[model samples]
Target: MKIQNKRLFASILFVLISVLCVAQGPPYPGGGPPGPPGFPIDGGILMGVGVALFYGVKKILGNK
Candidate 1:
């Protein structure tokens, strides 16, 4: 019971800290994503899809 209580306290503390940090984020400008002009809008999305596909193919082929 003591171990469970400690874990619960840690989880609550972590969530409170995360919320506080998010509330203190930098200011947004121009009512758009946080970046300068002409940012690669789909860069992160494309990279994520590419990585997922790569891993899927590797798993299908049993590379390990």
Candidate 2:
């Protein structure tokens, strides 16, 4: 019974918090400024990091 009550309280709190967060809005009254238009470079950076990590681990293991 205690655990059930705790879970119910947590659920209600979560819902209230989420609703309040969504209730707030940006201070701007009109449409925001236009953002940069171009392809994202994050993907390339992620791929490079992945390759580096893979090679580093492989080199550490001394597996050819």
The prediction achieving the highest TM-score against the true structure is 2
The alpha-carbon deviation from the true structure for residue 11 of candidate 1, after best TM-score superposition, in angstroms, is: 1.3
In model 2, which runs have C-alpha deviations exceeding 4 angstroms?
A: 27-44, 49-64
Per-residue lDDT tens digits for candidate 2, residues 1-64, read 6999999999999999999997988656674655678867788899999999999999989965
The parts of candidate 1 lying over 4 Å away from their true place are: 29-32, 36-64
TM-score of each: 0.41, 0.50
lDDT values for all models: 0.86, 0.88
When summed lDDT is taken over every stretch of 10 residues in candidate 1, the lowest stretch is: 25-34
Model 2: ten consecutive residues of lowest lDDT? 26-35
Cα-lDDT of candidate 2: 0.88
What is the RMSD of candidate 1?
Answer: 5.1
Query: In the order shown, what is each candidate's alpha-carbon RMSD?
Result: 5.1, 5.5
Deviation of model 1 at 56, angstroms: 4.1
